[model samples]
Target chain A: MKLTKEDIQFIDTYLENSDVVFADIRMEIVDHVASDIEDRMSASNTTDFYNVFKDYMVQNKAQLLKDNRQFLKSADMKIWKAFLKGLVSPLTPLIFLTSFFGFYFLYLNFNIETFRLIISYVPLIGLSGFLLTYVVYHKAKNLKRFSVVERLAMPFWVFYQIPNIIFNFSYQAKNLATVLWIVGIVSLVLTLMLVLVCVSIKLFKSYEKQYKTLA
Target chain B: MSNSKLYKGSLTTIILKLLNENDKMYGYEITQRVKELTKGELKITEGALYPALHKLEAEGLLDVEVAKVDNRLRKYYKLTETGTKETVNKLEELAEYIKTMQALVNPKLA
Candidate 1:
């Protein structure tokens, strides 16, 4: 079947309904996929616009969807968020490493017991929390469903955490390190879950906004 | 035959009606169907078709499924129950709009 302006309009309608990337992407053409289908239905084949769209969808929607996904995967939010998440936390590991060495030296040469107290907790729980958040960040990046990179990084990026977790691990404060570790891990997980929640909220709000506009 | 303003208004309704008739539809074939049906009266623009389809999907008036066709992944859209009802309402509104226009222009028909 030859494509008409009305048919294009029908496809446009279909895209608007299904694939977000396709809908939000460029639409310089005034004629839509649905209109193409309409034109065809009114033409010689006697095939209704409904049947034609059905056939076309069955034949072409998969490819269109894949293209649509790729278009969305390359979406600015995904890339920008990923990059920003990666960018903002560049110093997390470094800070952790620095504290790790600094504490070790202090333990070797210095008689100061306070540094010992701090280093104990820093590695035990605080470091664990930071690492776990790092893990969550990586997981979020690998999975493209929702946005959850920066919040996970907040604990990891926080300058005081490295020393805090290490210092908490001492004999005098083992329990403190444990508590901090638990909180860090739980917070990281919560941050990840909240990312999904936030995306859901955005999607719902967007839907409501669009539905209202159409209504 | 081409580039008329009157055609644009019914575009969504036409898509909904077509989807109501058939279970689902994709991109290229929908375009082909239009050419075959219109007998060259209307030509759809790709730039326009994609964005509209997405909006309808987002609105929940349509349901989409991704299936493989001809070694390519295709996204198919079918009208929801609400979509079917809306299609009828929209068509009726369009008809009423036309009638109103006729009353204004050709009062004898009114």
Candidate 2:
């Protein structure tokens, strides 16, 4: 049977305020209403649409366009898509900044004598800690628990690399400081990745938790 | 008319007890029956009723049959084996409490 506008109102009123029930019922209405409009067309479907569709929605005359129900999903979709796009889109530029400053300072600060002293005082053992941060942070895809290990690994970086970067590249201890300067560059790259991975994990976990609670 | 509060949490028990007495009922028919039996004192809202039916169906307490009527599909609910057992237990518990309330209220009224 073809439903009139009143028929739609009857069913909608019957469903009351249940949103999901309205969704399920309204899908059936669209199918049947379209089918009824299709069956009566000979001259033009355009001519029939006004007559058939108008009668079907005469009672929809009172409802706001938002009350149309069909547009509900589209209306609620855009804000979230933009928010998530904003969250991860800046990581590349930020990581590049870490790499540039890290490499440049190490290049500017090391000289032969202080670099030699850095070798005597700190050994290459700190490189192992920095390298561990570099490899593990990338390998894990920045999972949350990795951040705790990243924090513990950071101290070894400070002990080995940060102190060894001398301020003046023009100085006489220049050759030794230059070698130690290379270590600083490596540490800067590792440090940025280490911290970025930890920040990413916390954010990823928060997003996951938010979705779980919403569910 | 759709906004009356019946028993706070006993609607399920009431529905089970009523269905246990009869055979099966569709949503519209069940709402009609409750209104008739309760003299319009209990009106189940459609929003509340459908979700309750879905919850009972999920719990394995309600068996549902979908049938077409006059171009519209209607879902009918019946009790599962477990639901029948639950209905009997719930009715017995409610009856005992009613009897206790009657004894208390009768003397106070006297």
How does model 1 score by TM-score? 0.41
lDDT of 2 by residue, A88-183 (tens): 556645654665564455445765455445433432544554555555544554423322233334444554544345323324333545545455
lDDT of candidate model 1 versus the reference: 0.51
Candidate 1 local lDDT, A1-215, one digit each (tens):
44545545555556667743233331312123343444566665665666877865686566555555544433434333533444346454454345445555554465536645544454345435544544453354232222122333343344345444434444342354554443344334334333333343344343334323221
iRMSD per model? Answer: 12.3, 12.8
B22 in model 1: Cα distance from truth in Å?
1.1
Question: Candidate 2 at B41: error in angstroms?
Answer: 2.4
The numbered model that scores best in TM-score is 1
The C-alpha lDDT values of all candidates are 0.51, 0.50
Question: How do the predictions measure up, each by TM-score?
Answer: 0.41, 0.37
- RMSD value for candidate 2: 18.3
Please compute DockQ, using alpha carbons, for every candidate against the native two-chain complex. Answer: 0.02, 0.01
TM-score per candidate for chain A alone: 0.31, 0.24
